[model samples]
Target: MIFPIRSKAKVLALALLVISAATWLYLSVGETEYGRSLGPVAPRFSPTASLLGDLESRLQEAEEENRKLRLQLGEVRNEEQGTGLGSEGENSSHCDHRSLTEKCELIHVAIVCAGHNSSRDVVTLVKSILFHRRNPLHLHLITDSVALRILGNLFNTWMVPSLQISFYNASKLKTDVAWIPNKHYSGIFGLLKLTLTKVLPSDLSKVIVLDTDITFATDIAELWAIFKKFTGQHVLGLVENQSDWYLGNLWKNHKPWPALGRGFNTGVILLLLDKLRMIGWEEMWRLTAERELMNMLSTSLADQDIFNAVIKSSPSLVYQLPCYWNVQLSDHTRSEQCYSELADLKVIHWNSPHKLRVKNKHVELFRTLYLTFLEYDGSLLRRELIGCPTDGEQQETRQEALSKLDEEDPCYDFRRESLASHRVHLSFLPHQTPPADPYDVTLVAQLSMDRLQMLELICRHWEGPMSLALYLSDAEAQQFLRYAQASEVLQSRTNVGYHVVYKEGQLYPVNLLRNVALKNAQTPYVFLSDIDFLPMYGLYESLKKSIAQLDSYRSPKALIVPAFETLRYRLSFPKSKAELLSMLDMGALYTFRYHVWEKGHAPTNYAKWRTAVTPYSVEWAPDFEPYVVVKRDCPEYDQRFLGFGWNKVSHIMELDAQVSRLVFLFNGSL
Candidate 1:
């Protein structure tokens, strides 16, 4: 083993080089589960861990940036309690108390509504939000063609300050979420929530998605302030499900979707759009659904099931909201405990098939609030467009321009078109203010300038709300406003709304005028009539009594008010039904259009109406144009019919076609 010093050194260097080569080769060829090589690569990193780390880093960056912005704005969040953003505590006072100006941000709200009656619920939901809102809103609606038409008309008429609306047709997403099986009555509409981030504008970073069946008791600004409290790693905010359906103990063989604890209700949700996109939410949800659908037949709660599944898989993504924000009134859940503990109810969610009729001890209180918003006068939401000091200048300019309008030539015809395409002006002069309590029945009618005289006589006889759509030239409209201001009877009333449609080119859009009047009406019942007719004495009060007596509000029906006309314009108006009958026997009066068109009044069965003591149903007949008291949401008058011919006839025919019964009101008439 003896050798020269240089020979031994060479041997040591060669051995070290061989060992270094072996280690480099081993590192270049990465190891697999079976210790196999996959070419030169760095040491492996766990995909799960990397994904988690990247997501956390992105969220932390966002959180820090937001915190810095808040601090710059002179806002400080409590570090000791960690802002209590997603805490599950019941007594958390996380609501921000800063000035509205400091947080003057547009609140984005999304709603998925379809079907014919969906707009009705949505109207109430919007009303509830507008009732207590301090901040402006930008509402996003996902609806069908039918709901689009109805909601378009309604929201366009509502002139709330800083309220902006955008609509997306639900049909565009028919293919995206349709593959998943669902058994809920809402059908595919319930699944539309899964595609909100896809359907809404890409720039939208956050939104509040709400079910149409809910109402708000507090300012929506209170809820909007919550987004400022979200910490890193939280992408959604939701309230816990109040029912046991998710617990899988509702029945013997119940096989509900998998959930963590009681699950989360989807009626109200806060989505962080940017965070969701960053996490590849589409792929995440699709893969999750593919895995869960294998063990289930169909989802009972649609998107709700999938949402809970995702939350169960990643608990850190959700921020739990307070129960008061979503007070579930379903029959299967008892919210009395929540009510007893909370100081104020924030939102009411009618989340059951029975809705307000759900079997809950607090149903009456909840129902009362629901109906209050449902029957609320939409005109109250028409606050003037006053905003910040800069906005105030714009508003003042607008007011000056409008005042000039009042001073312009009353006879001059201005092509003033607003909101509608037909060159018509809506609410040219709306009611001064809404009544303290809504009128039981609003008298809805269409009139011309010549019929302006009838307004005084009608207002004298009827003191309820009157929604009048007038066909006037720009000049006549001015004259009408002057008349309204001068006439004591008309000036004193605060419940009369005047909607004007310009008398364009020879064809008078009678039906269009009628629809405007009907749509503007705020009462549950409206007596569709003409401006020339004067209602019999006490007809308004009597109809109110009859409405309460018949329970007509619950079961919608057309209460036929008998019509009679006189040949002489100067004849004394009938004071009572007995006097009208006496005059009829004396041949002083005849059934409306009786001499000219028998078919029109013949269907009313005047002979039977005179003797019948109680309301009786009448069969539909051709040319029947009897003025009737019907629900405000009745089929609109056919705009195709112009001038006087078949205008009312077509409307009554449509009502009859819909199987709506026409019953004679005992003594009411116009």
Candidate 2:
């Protein structure tokens, strides 16, 4: 195009006119990109290769800026999702607004859980953090590599975008604790949180570490707040522990009386990483090597003592948190659900040195709360807070706790009554029928190893019409059979059959064991008995008459005499039914022939249930009735069932199914 040269001012005026026109055109009749501007409308320069390069450079800078902005935007979205912050139905009561309201920072939370065995407790603790804390988090676990791997995989499975979890192998910390006695705290569970100060990342300025055996009732953001609360010299932020021994130790030994409140529970601690770094761990290790320090540490509560001793000169160095922050092993009176209000409790610590020895049913009842919380997704607000009074386990666990506390409180009323209603009983009755002719029945028993004397006593005391066959497992332990033979019990007895056979696995398959005896029984009639059972000849005679009266001596009849546990040892083997009866306890009725909870009805007594024992009724408790005198041909036991518990149930189930000309009878011999 042809153009005339013009002055700079006129050209500038023309450029301004074009820019004004383009702005008016854009406002009136828009271009591309919906709801966005297309930059300056009038071009400053015409299109050229070098101009495009400058444009590309500027575009590259803008692209980089956009990339950074997108990254920041993504982080905000992730933080919102992960923390559930500003989201409906999330914990907001104690969330630090300053932290949550701004660009979310990862609140690094350090926890020391020993291993996979401790995973359940850690899961609960971590869940509690998620449920309560409305901030991005970095969960650091001080545990074995194995446990770290397990938790890492679990956290990944959870896929919480806002939260980042990492595991530090604290197994190496064992070297730091190597000198401590195994009976001591460090020896038993490793060095614990003391080594955590050394193990945590040096770059991590602030972190809250807690023991696995804890539950957070408050949002963990409140815990993180303590790091900010710390004054100049405080290295540790911990809950004031009211341990009797710690109080006594401080009072008796340290010149100035240290307040009990000054004693801290390391279970929940906030570490000032920067300060701990300055404290110098070499000095701590040096204290361990010193004779005087080791002697002082030899005291039972050594872990806390080391902390106390190091910070003794300046108690101000230990920032004591309120007692409610960590309630230690205190609530034993009611289950957690029974708590009318947990408003005061921010955290609860199950701090018994001997939790395994807890005897208070109330304490155990309270423990159920901790256990339930552990199983929960770590949100207290979402939990069903009611005591499980109906749980049979609550009763059992309470009894255990009570047993432990029994020596301490004599008048502690065991609210859950003991199970004194042993539904099993025995009564003496005169024989209604004359004794039948003695038909020798072979008594077969399942065994891995037999007590030679007990087996001989059972065999010798076994009166007219009986023989013994033991299906010994062909385990390496079967060599105990040699011990049995060496004892002269077999030599002293008659027809004591010792048959050893190999079963594939290590387990004592009770059904297969019974089937072995069933198939091998030489007599037309087989009396299945446990090796421990002592058969009374007199009872046998009465039972034989019952079978003969029913004409089941050779018929397919299953005669089960209710068995009884005896105080009688091998030496105390009763010769007659009268003597055996004296040694007998209550009937072993822990088992039911039929499940009472299901369709099958459990009988009230031995006599009432006797007629009902068969395959037709699905509800039957066919158990070790001592002598199940079925014909040798009666369907051999089903070997499909496994273990001591299910194998016999399978047999009962089969018989109850009416598989054969099956008849159930209660012979009075047991």
Candidate 3:
């Protein structure tokens, strides 16, 4: 290695400057091995795909803690056993005659009404059996005439001196019976034979009856200890029985003398009265009232089919009980804590035929109790002799309450003060102009038989009276009356009006050209032409001045298109310029209106125009465009693809991604 040519050209320029600095650092880090790199410090990662994404996120948190411990072990084996009662306190005294517990006492209960009418819905069932009785009872309101005569004087002025109240009357019962029925006796079997033969108690034993639109929220000593744990020596406790009570056929040949189940609701019972007076329940209520056996049980389901045939032979003494003890109120179960779940309501029952309607929270609580006794116009014996009156009869009762404040208003006191002031005043008077364009344009064309010379140049350029329709696929009517007597615009439009349509195929030309143009097109605007497009001289006055400037701004519930034309020609021996541009790409010239083709009920078919234009886009030139092709037969003309032009450029890129400036009126040029 005896170098001399200038030190072997400086050792070949230091070995080509160390091979051009290692080919410029491997083309700047191997020119991005998978592309893109300017030089960076390495970091990269994958620790075994980050420990398999942290063990697939702790196996989805141990399958969500084993689906919450199998839904808390199927809700601890579907729980069950019930009973809860709460909320009721204010020194709560429905006459407190203590018995707190020794299995309960304070018994003097009596709800024995004579001719019981709904006495203001039995004052919410004697305020839900005096807010859950556990003693301190006494209602015994036996009545005679004035249907519970003002609920026995509002229960003798809201009773409660340990309650004790009585009223007795069927002219003081001593048997000549008659509890109620001079005439009106349909249901509740003439008031359950006027309460077990003239108001109960033939040595009482235990009674409960109920049904004046029931309502007792719990504790009638916990429903008398579940009615002495199902009346041990049964006579009645009620409840269990619903297979809609053996759906008729006279309960399958009458056999169920004590049937054990399927019909009870004498709307909440309890009864035992010493086994209803030793099984001759008052001589079966005097032989069901001298054999009327409730008109021989002809099904009015009144005294619930004669207490289900006098307890069908005593099916182990009759008990059943629990549907949360008598809920009833239907229209799919009523609510508002169903009247404070009245002690878990051992009764509730308003049994709907829409229970006397009114409810909007009882019409705003009787319009706030008629604006809190709208100046009390007494007569409950002058509000029980004005016990709380004077400031001179409350200032002469506020000047006779402003002279009887429009005779105590209330039919929902102005709809509960207009739904508690959500305002509604309007009294009428406002129409300042603007309301005119109610449609009227009608052009229809649709002829066929190889377009009778383009339907005689659209009846020689339609000068009004245009509604042709013709369609005839297999030509008849003597070959369309010999091609309309050699067409001269069908001998100068004999007052242009034809509708033919006999095409029995291709579903008879889409249902006989939309049912002969929706039953003889009587125009409110239609124009669906096809006899080879030749409408150029101001195309029907520029589509009726763009539909009267779209019915003067704001009337476009549809028309967003226009401008079209296409008439090329050439096809051999028996015609074929590709069958004349497949009959000029079949979108028969269009125009619309007659209430948008009477809401697309036009020429029915195309599945009733895709169910009357749903999700929009109905076609058949749903308004075609491009230099409205007036005449293009040149070397098979192609003015850069026309009308329905790539479906109006994919409906203008879906109307520029749903609506904005969408004015399209092309007249074909490219």
Candidate 4:
């Protein structure tokens, strides 16, 4: 080693030369593809082998844990079986298992009517409970006069004699005490005072309290059975798990015992009277009601808040049932995930004033079903029940009246005979209006000129002065001679009148057609007719009656809208014809005179007038079809509105002050 060290200078020079060559080679070759070809291959690990080893260890550990847990569970089960404490077996008694001598009886329920009254809803609740429950039950009505009078009478007259019931006036119990600010509190203070002051029997074991609006669709016996089976360490209550900071703060400040769950809805409660007495709950209630105590605890919580605070910290006595037992009636549509729970709802608590404003079919069905629960008689029953009369007496009486009136009335036979004859012209007069002078109600069949032959029978039977305005577009006429032939056929059918208006020169087709009609119409009122719309025999008579009822200004009192029945052969176009037909069929039949024009109304303004009045009026055709307007004063439709929704709002705003009243006649089936 010493001899080698003697040549350190020479060795250092050699090492430097070697390092420089290696660096030069690396720099020159590594930058090119040829350099990469000289590199060593990397080694790969066996991931599968590693993963298997990890899994095997986990499996052994899990098996060991499972064995220990099973052993512990077995020991606990043996102890429970020996003591006969837990009612886990199929043969376990539904009643008190601890004391074999005692048996559970029917639960006595009392409805506490506090702030508001829902007597009709309560009646349904009572009826539903009675119908479904097999256990012997008694309903104790505790309410003020507002709830008692309505519910008492309905129950007395209608409820079958099989159910046992009693009524107690809660108002007579001096229970007026403030439990919360800005809200009227009832029941808690009053009921507590009654129990403490010896007004109520202290010996009572248990009582179930329900709100007035709750509906019981299924038997509650199973829930009661579960409650009885459990050790009576705590009073049973329904927990509203969604309680917020307001409730938490109440508990914090009041320094009451903490409970596991949050807040409980006072709407439904089960009180263990014996346990409450033993715990001196009456004295606690009295102290809590005192002004000094309330002032101190008021910031912490209300009566419920205080109760929860004390109960939560002291002992675990409260239990929460399924949410379906008390379904909250709300506006937000429940998702499918929540439907299973909602479908099984036994009690619906309508929590909001706007609850009925919801429009879902499921909610509507729920409401209808709930209404059936309150059946007073057939009339009330019919509201929820199908094929039932709303009133029990009306069912029998209306049937008799309908039968007798059928024999006495001759109009029905006349209508039948007229329909069978297939007469082209007939008259329908309003029941209130007298016969007036008949004016020529011109039925101008405005078609695309190709549908002329289809109108031959309609034109031939025009007994009232009628006219035909054939509006043919340049394209339609230029493209096909069949259209021209159809127009010629229509003209030949009737000599009442005919005007062939070529739409080639007009800027807008509909406007040009209307202008032609306005210039040619000789009648005081022009009937706006679509090509597909056909008049039944009594159509003009109906128009005359509607026109006669108009005010002195000759402004239409109501437009006699035509009812259009669909024909099987006519094919509809999606973009143009179908839309136009829909507008003609479904657009509002009634138009306001004020909206047409301020100075005077014309036949052209009828289109705009109809749009404005249809939404507001009740007078509509059964088929949602446009009404036949036999204008008393030839109200011109605004020709500027050639296409739909064009200048419609501006035109409507202009005539806002002129329309007085609108009538809509809705056909019930549509």
lDDT of each candidate versus the true structure: 0.75, 0.52, 0.42, 0.45
Question: Which candidate tops lDDT?
Answer: 1
Residue range 1-670, candidate 1, lDDT tens digits: 9844334444545655565555445444423422453456855444466755665575566556545544433322233235463223543434446422244567899999986456657877988998887677889999987677656765654445677889999999989889999998889999999999899999999999999999998888777767776888999999889888888967888888888899999999999999999998888888888789999867899899999999999999998888878888877655655555334688889886687678787788788888788656555664643453223343455456555554366522231211122424454443544444443889999988878888988888888888998987645665786787788887687788777665555567788889988998888888988888788878888988887777734545778888888888588887877888998999999888788989987877888878877888888888888888877788998776665688888889888776456755556556
How well is each residue in 1-670 modelled by candidate 4, as lDDT tens digits?
A: 4422224434444555565555556446534532234346644334466655665675566556556655555565456544434432222223343433113244577765532234434655665666556555667766666556445544443423234567776656544444433222333432332232233345657777676666676665644554553455676555353334323454545343233455555456666667767767656655544533544444233345445544555445665544555655554443111235444555665544555556554677667766555432221222222232223343345345455545456554432222211001000000111224444456655445556565665654444545555554323332333443446544353324434443422233453344444444446565655555545545555555545444344433334352333334543422322343464466432222334432222322344433453322433222122433444343445554443333323322322324432342211100
**Cα-based TM-score, every candidate:** 0.54, 0.40, 0.20, 0.37
**Weakest ten-residue segment in model 4 by summed lDDT:** 421-430
Provide the lDDT at 444 for model 1. Answer: 94
Q: Which digits, one per residue and each the tens of the lDDT, describe model 2 over residues 1-670?
A: 4332223324444555565555556445432333345577943433467755665575566556556655554555455534333321122233445443222546787777654346546766776667666667778887765466446644543444366677777767777765665334534453466676677787888788777777777677666765665666888887656445444644545432233334666777778888877977546534633534444435355455556555554577777665556666643332232223456457767665565345544466446656555444321222221331122343355457656655455433322122111110000001111133345466667655445346656656665333333333223222543565476644454344443333333444555556655664556566766676666556556655665665633534566655544332334444544453444423322222333322222332433443443322122455422246665666667654444454555565665455343345453434
Q: Candidate 3 residues 1-670, lDDT tens each?
A: 6854334444555654555555556455533542454357754433466755665675566556556655544443233111111111111122122323333244434443333234434445655565545454555555545435545544443323344456556445524444323232333233443355336556657756666666654566655554445435677777644334334455556432233355666666666676666766766644554454334434344455546665664466676566545655543323333344333334545543354353534334423332222212111111111222222333344355455455456532332222110100010011111123334344554555666566666655555445555545222423665666676656665445555443321222322342343334444444544455555443554555555555554422233323223332432211322332344346332223323333322322223322232222333233322221110110112212222224333332333333323332322110
Choose 2 or 3, whichever is better by lDDT.
2
Off by over 4 Å in 3: 1-54, 64-112, 115-124, 129-143, 150-215, 218-305, 310-670
Superpose all Cα atoms of candidate 3 onto the true structure and report the RMSD in Å to 1 decimal.
39.7
Ranking by TM-score: 1, 2, 4, 3
**Better structure of 1 and 2 per TM-score:** 1
Q: Report the Cα lDDT for residue 655, model 1.
A: 87
Q: Is candidate 1 or candidate 2 better by lDDT?
A: 1
Cα RMSD to the true fold for all candidates? 22.8, 23.2, 39.7, 27.3
Model 4 earns a TM-score of 0.37
